[model samples]
Target: MPEGIEARLQEFDRKLRDGHFELLRQFLAKDYFGYSPGPGEPAASDRITDLVTDLKAALPDLTVAFDNIAVDAEGNATAEVTVQGTHKNELWGVPGSGDAVGWTGPVSIRAIGDRFAVRLDDLATPQRVGLVRQLRLVNPADEMDQPPHFPVVWPEFLLRLVFTGEVGDRPCSHLDQITVSDPPVSVCEQCVESDHIWPALRMCLVCGFVGCCDTSTNRHMAQHYQETGHCIFRSIRDDEGWIWCYEDDAFFDKAMLDRVG
Candidate 1:
């Protein structure tokens, strides 16, 4: 709603369209940092410029259409943008097949006078990465020192254990697979990397992505929730039978979930 905020965003969009990387510097705060979902410091402004440059080089017709711009009382702005371009060169190790690629994602930026501090949406980059994976353009890089897969620790599968019987009408879609697999998969699928320790684990039934518990040092389960938008995760710990919906912020009984399997 602020006129100056809208003007600044439009200016940034123009810079992106024209490949005016130098001009973009003027719009960024001196202490600007861009964030993705990771356990590292947010990337500097230069990094984003570099990414834009690379994308422009690969897709000469690259253009962005911004929509749903919302500016709060604090002059913080969020926008949903759709980027479209024809793939003409390799990106992220994916060879271009001369196809048109378009993806929609969100962006957040803070206005400080004429400059803004951008926090790049955490899901956008991964959505693009996963798109490349889905196209089969490149093989997944080999994982090193892979940890064991799930179900290895349980010697005997317990079929009758139920954590709670009261789900209170919450939509629990995660329990569908429980009828087929007594304990679901064995290890945390995402924590199989080396040197990762987890106090507990849960599995997302919607996608089978395993993330470490909230108490873990990395708290990868929460990260997984943010990245995938999958709302439910079931306890994978020994003899545990509870399921949680991240969106609802409520606990549910495994019995009430839809049996999709």
Candidate 2:
């Protein structure tokens, strides 16, 4: 933890996850520099933002629990986080069937001066990504289609097949956490919408409520916990989705699971 930077970094993830772009822009520098191979088929800054936006929609209660944050004396910080949420909406282009999916990946951020200047990384699980590539088989966008801009041409079920694995054969219990903007008080969120917002966000074995990816902006997923005092959510949209808990104020990993029980 780096003094105020740790909390600040967490706040940034929340803002991005919450679809608070204005806040993100305010906290980040106008001319920031970032580098990574992510969402954009072409991988550009805007595409990265779009990808983040999409992820938010996919997992309304999406939370990026950070693993480590390193900030130097120069105010430059790089944090590694695992984005957890659900798949409840349209990803790529196909409509998500409110399935339980989760993605496991890392995010890299760069901070400078009084704000972050750049950030990049792929956030979805390799399985979901493969599904997207497979989808390209149908409605292939020219290689010129920028990442975050290209569209997947398969049904949402393919993602489940590639990511969720066989129902009982999951790597971990308390799988994917669904997220929504305005849950029905009963369900944390829904991902049936084109934007990945499931009506009811599922809970994992650890008792956290993560949301779908950026598709539906199921902000209510995190909001539900914040309102009800629950933490720990997984991306229900990625096959390898992980956990994010506010109590620990961090993301879940193998070590966490070891300690949780």
Candidate 3:
């Protein structure tokens, strides 16, 4: 590993912590690719810029600390990063509670010459869920407010199922029709083309069509089911692996699927 890799990584971390996103561009390669980008963000650099901008806006006092940065001879680097800040503004539709919140997870960076050509932050899902919990956005007692839809307060529903063992209903026959389990694309193509935001994404199990969840304004997944008569879909959201059947109005978690299978 080049000695400059560690120095560049440290500088990247410092720039991010200082909210100097524009200066951080020197650490990224021209062909850099991040984990996933939103509707209008076409380039990986754009995705990183938007993410940090939103984070800074939501948590003005945000701080990021990177530790245990190790780089191999192949120029692949890994580090543990902890992000901490005060929730002072709205984030992902959750109103800020003015409370201190944080999450720690691993991150990967690949050195290309003197800049990083790839960056993958593994903390997004856990951080969002932890922030929601800290803001008291999820309430297990508010079952009435939770519709049969998959994305609404889904973490709370999962907690209830795990602790109470309240398996709602039997699996629908559509599970047999799940021929495609993986999503071909990360973003909803329709949403990207229309420049619309999708709260979450789903994949049609029958034909592997990727669409936005029902909570999105477009409800592209539901529309896909309606247009193609494909009823079974699975969540492709971060850290979510549950299945839903629109025709049967049924939901199945990984545990339930294993039990029934």
Candidate 4:
């Protein structure tokens, strides 16, 4: 590591130790993105600042020690940090347990020119989960139950291709490739034939066939799935942006739906 980078890390420690948050912001890149695991987007400066302030209020004696700092030639660095604190107040909607906890976790930082952006890996360990539960960040019942299905999916190969493009193993339906049906086909094509109304509509990724969603009276989408074995469908309504796979029982964000359409 360059002496300058090491010095910067030391300065970061000092600023955090003194609760100099505004001073810390001066060291971060303007477009910083940080990863946080629970319920929010990756952290930017404002988000991290808010979290730090809330944590400080809840744990007045909180302190951290950074170790195993490793910097690459490209100005990216990572470290493991040991954190100790006492739960003393409400945080993230959870009332404090009034207990002291200590843990170690990893942190990563990337430098853009002289400024840096940081990401913290707050994985859900038993201790961390317990702490968050006590803090009310999550419902205790939901935490104790089986976790829901994974919410995000990005296939490893062909990741560079835009999702709306033709890069998936499944061939695009001839109708989809030709032109999307005008007016977005708000009604399910099959439901109209059966003289039934559907609550929602789903479009087949492979064939652009509009079918009623599973909740609809007819469940045309499931029928389509059974008959044609077309695995993926997207909500035709503009309100939702998720694609579902019947075979995998998985959901994909539109950006990762390249394989289907």
> How much is 87 displaced in model 3, in angstroms?
0.7
lDDT value, residue 227 of candidate 2: 76
Most TM-score-accurate candidate:
3
For lDDT, candidate 1 versus 3, the one ahead is 3
lDDT of 3 by residue, 1-261 (tens): 656888888888888777676764677664443233223324444444555566678788888767788887776888876778898987645667798988666667778677775443543444434544554554333332232222333442333222222212324777777788788998889988998866678999899999998656788999999999999988886477677888875665645555556
Put down candidate 2 lDDT per residue, 67-184, tens digits, no spaces: 5667776556666545555566666565654545444433445554455544434423443354244323222333322223334443322232233321011123332332432222
Q: TM-score per candidate, in order?
A: 0.45, 0.38, 0.51, 0.49
Ranking by lDDT: 3, 4, 1, 2
Q: Report the candidate with higher TM-score, 1 versus 4.
A: 4
Q: Once model 2 is optimally superposed onto the true structure by TM-score, how far is the C-alpha of residue 257 displaced, in angstroms? A: 49
- TM-score for candidate 3, please give it: 0.51
lDDT of 2: 0.45
| Better candidate by TM-score, 2 or 3 | 3
* Per-residue lDDT of 230 in model 4: 77
Ranking by TM-score: 3, 4, 1, 2
Higher-scoring candidate on lDDT, 2 or 3: 3
Instruction: Find the number of clashing residue pairs for candidate 1.
Output: 6
Question: Using alpha carbons, what is the TM-score of model 4?
Answer: 0.49
> The CA-based lDDT of model 1 is what?
0.56
Q: Which ten residues in a row have the lowest lDDT in candidate 1?
A: 155-164
lDDT for each candidate structure: 0.56, 0.45, 0.64, 0.56
Q: Is candidate 1 or candidate 2 better by lDDT?
A: 1
